[model samples]
Target: NRRGLPEGHADVKRMMTVPIMRNDEIVAIVGVGNKAFDYEAEELEVFARYADSVWDSIQVKRVEDALWQSREIYRAVVENSTDSIVRCDVNGKFLFGNEAAIKLLGGAEAAPIGKTPEELGFCPAFRHTWDASLQYVVAQGFPASFEFDMEIAGRTQTLDMRFAPEYSPTGRVVSVLGVARDITERKIAERELARREEQYRVLTETMKDVVWVLDIESSKFRYVSPSVYALRGYTSEEVVALPVDHAMTPEDRAALKALTLDRVAEFESGSLAADHFYVDQFPQPCKDGSVVWTEVVSNYYINPDNQRLELRGVTRDITERRQAEVALRQARDTLEQRVEERTRDLTRVNAELAAAMQVKDEFLSVMSHELRTPLNAILIMSQVMLEGVRGSLNERQLRAMQTITESGQHLLAMINDILDITSVQAGTVVLDRALHEVDALCAPLIDRLRAEAATRSQSIDYVCPSEPLYLWADGRRFGQIVRHLLENAMKFTPDGGQISLFVQPDLDRRVLSVRIEDNGIGIAHDAIERIFQPFTQADSALSRQFGGSGIGLTLVRHLVELHGGTITAESAGMPGSGSRFTVQLPWQAPPVGSPHGAILAAGAVHGPHVVLIADDNPSAQRVMGDALRAAGYEVLAALDGIEAVATARLRPPDLILMDMQMPRCDGATAIRRLRQLPACAATPIVAMSSVVVPNDRALCLDAGADDYLAKPISADTVVDVVARHLAPGRSLIDAASGADARPS
Candidate 1:
């Protein structure tokens, strides 16, 4: 019945039966109708042969189908797994691309299939690998696998490709199969890790520090950087073979072992940090067998597999830095010590300066008082003699009296200089304010010195401006300054030398310049700077020839400065040249109700009564004493402090006459001591000294003396001082009393 089916149905059944092969065998059969038309004998024979051949082909295909299924399962399992998979043909053409590969390529498997390695942009190494795989597969007829680098879509990729040869039953080549995995990420990670390891190795090798790894359990070197050779004179290989403990001396080894064991225990107990310390583990011996100092930082690492601890450490030679640190510390200490020493020295200097200043003040005070006392006696006695209080004298006696007067005046001038210098040095000079007409103030001084100048055959020319120059200043001090400059010029100038004085306004600076120029011995270049210093002469010979204390210019400079002015000297060096002195004074107008009228009124008086006498020599004292006794009233004698105090106490004298120096006590000390006594305290003390400083008069006043008068007492000074200090009635009475007084 199955054979009687229609021809169409029979073909249909055949088609279904071919597909029904399972497990490589057919379990049942399906029948179809016979051919529609009756077959001839030839046709029937052809059909039977075809049917037999078809059945054989179906059975062979069944085996092939089973193998193909098995292969599909294997492929699915391999490809669907998380691993990347690919397959290529002998020519390196993609035969299959798995899910992982498709995902890596960001596409479906069909996109990569049928593409050659070149088309897929595989790198040369991959292409070569593929070719080698193909060659090996062809030769051995077996599978092969290799790692390769490929460039896919401009990105490099790493792949592990496996090749398998498909062989026929005779073992002849048929086709080749390849499985590829995209191991790009894994390869990259591996390469990065290797690179990091190489970098670490290079860093360690190049470092100045020594790096080491040791096996804790055995105390043996696991690794050491090449620099260990430089540090400890041991190669890495040699060190690795020996126990780390063996490299250390016995004492150091014991210490290291103890320290390492402790650290390992602490690490196991979770009590030790990554950082630990070890002392002198690796000592580098120098050429001379001396050891260099080193410091080590050690840490522990536990191996994951073995649970063994490794001691990894770095050793640094800190000798140089440490030495530098020591040196810096030493320098700091030294600097601090020097600062302390300097501070101490400065403190001592300050103390000494303070003491010196104190001593200076005391000395000035004492000197002023003592010198004034002697000057008073000389001045008073000189006045009495000039008044002709005794019987009329001969021409010789009158001439001698005149000499005494002149000498007394000279000595008084010297004492005044000393006081001025003392005051200037002590910074105590004061300006007495008054209205002064420049020409009028200078007139008297010029007239007085005119005769002296004429005696030298020198001409003093006064050039006054048409308009009067009136200023507010100390008139006496200003006159003194002008006179000093003029006198200086006169002394230096030879006979017939021309001296000129003139006043002019300095338009730019609003000042008045008083210039005195003379055809005199010019100052040398070397002496110019020192000329203004007190007691400094230009040259020793000049000092001797000039007969000056060298304080005139200094006093002039001080007075000018006090008046807010400046004075300067100019000369064309040496003989045959002339000298010029220019004084510049700030212009200040006099007050509306100034004392100019009073000064003129006072000038009208022919003389002053107050007397001051100062002398250092004893013979000058007797001569002065005899003159003063013949004149009138009480006389006080002070040989020294003792005599001065006794005489002053016996009678409170109108004025004190002082000597600068005396036996038993110096004049300065004597004056100070006398000033302390009550009786003589109020009396006017006058300073007299051979040695005169620029500020001596001021110094005398500062020590409580009233005025200054110099040595070699004169009759006129005595008469002048008595007239100045006495009441008008007393002065009149003394003038009359002079006729009755007897010569001593």
Candidate 2:
């Protein structure tokens, strides 16, 4: 008999004895050397049965031991795995937990065992899943896997959990084994991929050019951007299912196929890549049965896996650009045509201006020659009559001759207007300044126009400042402005109308303001602004009714502006109403070094003083000298400044009226010479000239004369100036009027 011992045990060193039993017969007994305890009969009987029974029982026990060892190894592996391992009862309470599960829970290893999921901070996201998973495990007794998000230990975690049911002998689930893995990072990666995909989709939709990808083997489109809908009216999905050639026109499709094949062959052969192909006018059919132009560019893309090639590229709609090019070409042609037309028009206009200028020059020449000749003849004839060379005339005849002379003067004024207008148009109006008394400059003009006003039964009231008003100005032009404005007022006014003139100093503005107001046929409101334009009348009827050239106000405005002043006309806008014209001129004080000899000389000449007059025209001389003599002054006569000077020297006359433009010595030179003599130096000498321009008076006065006078001087004006200079302290006329008139 053999004893069963543990596997790989060493053999016993001493032999031992045992009894054997066979078929109800006693077997031989064997004696052992020694034993620790006596073998009893009952123990031997148990051993005797095991000789057969013991061997079989030993084999069964050995099988049971191997199975238990394998189970232990599997249990250790499950307990030590990185993944959390757990076993739960049917009620979802934790029945067992490995070290991983305990560590994952971040607490003591003994804490989780026998605890419910709720006690360990495990709550199901959906309550229904708990009941379903429980029911499934109980009914099926099988393993199942599920995904869930759970909050564990104050943090959210994604879990992939597998539940395996533990069954009893009756096939009922006693508990469940669960294996769980944290999959939070995996879920985050999946979400990030989805977000990027959405971004790409949005970018493709908003882009202008069509983007597409093709499957090389199938020769069909796999991807198409949403922009294809805008360019070709084909939805992305529709284009993606169709071959690329289907979208192109037949001609373009053929060309594209050839090019694609060539590129594919080159790529497969490992040769140089075929050149990238571009077609600007590739035709595409729209959903509306219309054709559109597209620009296509493509290259061959070799598929790495199977060595297949695909044509992938973009297509842009070029219809608008093409239309713009066509329109631009047409515009270029139109611009060229317009440029030629303008050139021709300008050439014609230039020729017309040249012709007009030539005609203007010819007209001015003829007008000057014709007007001057007549004016010269009339002037000469008037001088001859006034000189007594044509014999003495009666009062009536003298008056008639005076009328003739005045008419000639008026004609000469018209001629001057013509000449001035021509010169102004030719751009030749220049400023020439001289110092003179404003009142004296305006006095002769006022006297001449007075008679004209009287003829119309009108009266003019003139007022000047009490103090002498001196100004540096162009005297002739200054007089012209006054004359034109005065004449304009008198002509428009009806008989019995009143005209008033005034001069005042404007100290703040440093200007002299001269105003002339009249009761007349006033200008209309619309006509006032245009009245100063040359040749412009208030109305065509005004030209006929007033008998004016309409250039008077225009010339007045120009002359006033030339002196750095402005003139304006204001009217009541009705016939027989009133109009006022105001002129403002810049004023400069006279130099202190200038002589006031004229003022001193006027003081020397007392009442009834002898005054000698020298003028080539006898009428002027007589009228002047007689006016002086009549006003109580003794008068002497001479033909010119030379004769006047000589006569004054001979008779020791108190004053001399010298004609400025004389044959021998001019008044300016004569006065200069006479001033050198002590006897004449203190004498009052007045120089007269017809051309009373600004410099003329200054030239005379600068040469030592007492005062300068402009011709056709009136009797009152000549007497007034002469008297003022003769006796500065006395009444102006007191010097002219002898004792026959009272001093007052």
RMSD of each: 22.7, 25.0
lDDT of 2 by residue, 587-706 (tens): 533234434444223323432356778778887875675455434455678886678667767777667788888887777778887787777888888878788576887877788877
Model 1 ranges off by over 4 Å? 1-84, 89-93, 99-126, 165-175, 185-199, 213-222, 236-289, 295-314, 318-744
Deviation from native of the Cα of residue 468 in model 1, angstroms: 24
Per model, state how many residue pairs clash.
Answer: 58, 6
Q: Cα miss at 583, model 1 (Å)?
A: 17
Candidate 2 has a TM-score of 0.48
Q: Write the per-residue lDDT of candidate 1 for residues 1-744, one digit (tens) a residue.
A: 466757664333222112233477764453233455554667645555566577678879999999999999997797777666666555656666668766654467337778775676556776677687687878887777888776666787777877778777997776676566778888889999999999998899999898988887787888888887776677889889976654555556677667767766778898756555545435545434556667777777787768788878888887777779879999999999999999899889988987997787788678767766776677677678778786677889878877887777777788788778777776778666543578888888889889888888999999888766655467889998999899989988888899999988654454678999998889888888789999887788988898889999999999987665678888888696988899977553222453555433332321112223334465776556544433323344556756766666654566667766667766677678777878667666766665677887776667666666765557558646654655442331232223221111
lDDT of 1: 0.69
Q: Write down the TM-score for model 1.
A: 0.41
lDDT, each prediction: 0.69, 0.75
Off by over 4 Å in 2: 1-88, 94-125, 133-223, 226-325, 383-389, 393-403, 422-486, 493-519, 554-744
Per-prediction TM-score to the true structure, in the order listed: 0.41, 0.48
